[model samples]
Target: MTRVFSERSSTRATRRPELEAAVKLAGEIRSSDVAVTLVVHEHKWLGRGTELAMLTEELKTSDVGLEFLTGELKGSHGPSGIVFTVLAAMSGMEREYLRDQEVSLRDIATGAKKGQHSSPATVMRMLREHDEQAATAASA
Candidate 1:
């Protein structure tokens, strides 16, 4: 079993009942450790923004360790940093999407030509288009 430590009296602990209870248990047992097994079921657990951010923080901080209780499970051990990295990238993409939406609204208001869409998938597309434009300009 893996053990995770919780900082008692933390603001987050107060906010989250699970964390608060864990903290209380740790205090009662004279050990600041809690064991947790992470199971992702059909991507539902990761869909929530607040939950995702909290879980990421929990994984990042303390002495939290990941363990698979199921014998049939075949995957990499422990929590991977890739999860957080992907989350961060997704967050960036979301920000970009919002920015693109704002730009589109502004363009509409100003009656400017609507250009290419600024989306996560369009990142590479935009780069390719920019490169092509640069190449054409250079040729000219």
Candidate 2:
């Protein structure tokens, strides 16, 4: 049992760096407004956790358009069985936005779209705007 457990634990630990890298990469990609598929392909070995983390962090700041795609990564598929619940908090805002008005998900999606050449501040501002909208709506 001890040997089995250690082996399993070791496997989990080995994937951590990959997951971290993927998360960081996803965050970078989200900020850029570049399609994640393009970004994922450009960088080989972007582990699921890292990508998920990046998306989660990015969504935390703005309205992440591809929630379904992000949801796909939340299950046991990722390395080390890491889940993507970190993004759930964003869903509430997403849901509220969808419920309140005739807003198109496409528009919100487009609103957060960043050009491949956009600056980090631009991405940060977009995320901030999404958060501000959500906060204001919640208060009202």
- Stretches of model 1 off by over 4 angstroms after superposition: 1-31, 48-51, 63-77, 103-140
Tens digits of lDDT, candidate 1, 10-50: 22121455544543443344334544444332222232223
Worst 10 residues of 2 by lDDT: 1-10
Per-prediction TM-score to the true structure, in the order listed: 0.36, 0.24
Q: Which stretches of candidate 2 lie over 4 Å from their true place?
A: 1-15, 37-59, 62-140
- Which residue pairs of candidate 1 clash? 4-34
Q: C-alpha displacement of 114 in model 1, angstroms?
A: 24
Candidate 2 — what's its lDDT?
0.36
Per-residue lDDT over 1-140 for candidate 2, one digit per residue giving the tens place of the 0 to 100 score: 00111112221122445444444555576577754421121111222222333544454454223222222232222211122242333333443444355555554343332222122223335568989999999999
Candidate closest to the true structure, highest lDDT: 1
What lDDT score belongs to each candidate, Candidate 1 first? 0.41, 0.36
